[model samples]
Target: MLKSFDNKALEELNDSNASENERAKKGLKKRSDFGYAVLFLGPSLLLLGVFVFYPMIKTLYMSLFLTNNFGQTTIFVGLKNYTSLLTSASFLASLSSTFIYVIGVMVLTIVLGLALAVFANQKLKGIQFFRTIFSSTMGVSVSVAAIFFLFVFNPTTGLLNQMAGLLHLPQLNWMTDPNLAMITVIVSTVWMNLGFTFLVLFGALQAVPRSLYDAADIEGASKSYQLFKITIPMISPSLFFVGIVTLIGAFKSFGLIDLMTAGGPNNATNLLVYRIYQDAFLNGNYSQASTESIVLTIIIAVMTIIQFKVLEKRVNY
Candidate 1:
């Protein structure tokens, strides 16, 4: 009876394997069938081709030409526009301003977000309330935030100046002053980005194991020591992710600059993205704009690569 049962079980296992092999063979035969894939992916591919690839290719092509106000290409310049932009004082200034804005925003957002997340992660009463408050700005639209800051940063008749007057402090121009304009915009951007960064870091903090902290405590580690040795290492992945995102967002910022400064006060806050916009629309220099666009894209790509190369090794996971 035992022998018969063993043989029967082996036969059943063989039958199951045979059925699976047949099904796999059928699946292999059907692999060439792309009807469903085309049905699903055709629309997305078409959209990408029309909207993304075509524009990108056109921009590259246009960058090699001299375009008129009527969007007509007059001559093939073959990187002359790029050379001119590279040698131009205004373009260089815009590039410098872009770096300042991107770096400042990235640093401030990551530091403040991590600080707030650590604070919120502590066990205390009303912690949830503070977390909600810190994350509230995530819901604010970019236009609305820019408008709100416009009022706040107004040199005269603004809340900041009014408060300064109450304390008899000297009123400083926020938007009009070349020295202060870029700083003002950077601060506003940092604030606008804070909510999302804070939320991400906050979640990352929660996911860190309490056992690690307990172990550190048992080892008589100081809070600061634990923070540097353990907490930061654990959350470094989140920090890196947020840093990359903030870097890109800073590079692409346009709305706040448009609303508040409009690259005013001698082009003090004229970042690369806004410069591109101005060249294309306001000045009707499409070729130059496209050249700057390409440059901007390359700059962003390089920065992203550098960040990944340098920062990825530090991330714990």
Candidate 2:
């Protein structure tokens, strides 16, 4: 027994040494591969450092000093730029409209997209064609979508007004009216984003195990019951993903706001991103624009964190 125990201990010691030697070999191999790794990754890192990191650092630096139209430093205002934006009525209005537009777009886009995705997921005849049509907007560019909607919302020969005339309904100012302009842009944005949202949710729907629905059917569950209970819970992950994406996308919305209302009849549709552009290029207040850019970044980060904390618990997977 003593001899057997001694042999067993020696075997364990040998195994440990062998494992350590293998690890050391791996470490040496990794050191030798370091040059190759750097060769492959160096160019990409250099590009990002120049284009992405430098600009970000520059924006932060510029936020501290007021810059002229030529981007030359005019004054070092430190926190004053931030405090001024907090009190400016125009800034406040822009903030308010930004929230309204974001919420409107997120809600409408998700709801409409999910609905369309569910319908397209049905196994009816020609469903493939319908699915293609539903997601066709994904191919449309933002500029083109905005311009197309421009013609559709035009006053005299616009499709909406033309239909209204035929129905004897009053012509509505979709763009000029302060109250309606925000809603109109929201509608167009939702339409533009619907295809992507639909595709995401549809893919999720398709991935759902059919066995769950089969069990629900066997138990005599109603269609609505299966949808609300089984289908929704099964797809909660996709819903959560879409919620985050749409929320961020809506916050970053600029093209629609610019091409449609140019940030408004009364600055009613002035979102933060567009406001940033206005300050930097048109107003030539680079400092204020940089400050707003920082604020927008913080806003997006904070809201995304909040959304994660609040919604993550409900995501089934």
lDDT of 2 by residue, 1-317 (tens): 01123334555789998987898988754245678879999999999999989988898889889888898877888888889989999999999899898889989988899899888988899999999999999899889999999888888888999999999999999888988888889989999988888998999899989899899899999989988988788888778778777888888999988889999888899899999999999998899999999989888777666555545354555
Q: Which ten residues in a row have the lowest lDDT in candidate 1?
A: 1-10
**Can you write out model 1's per-residue Cα lDDT over 170-207, one digit (the tens) per residue?**
99899889979998899899999989999989998999
In model 2, how large is the Cα lDDT of residue 216? 89
What's the CA error at residue 264 for candidate 1, in Å? 1.3
Per-residue lDDT, model 1, residue 159, is 91
Q: lDDT, candidate 2, residue 149?
A: 91
CA lDDT of each prediction against the hidden true structure: 0.86, 0.85
- Using all chains and alpha carbons, the TM-scores for the candidates as numbered come to 0.87, 0.87
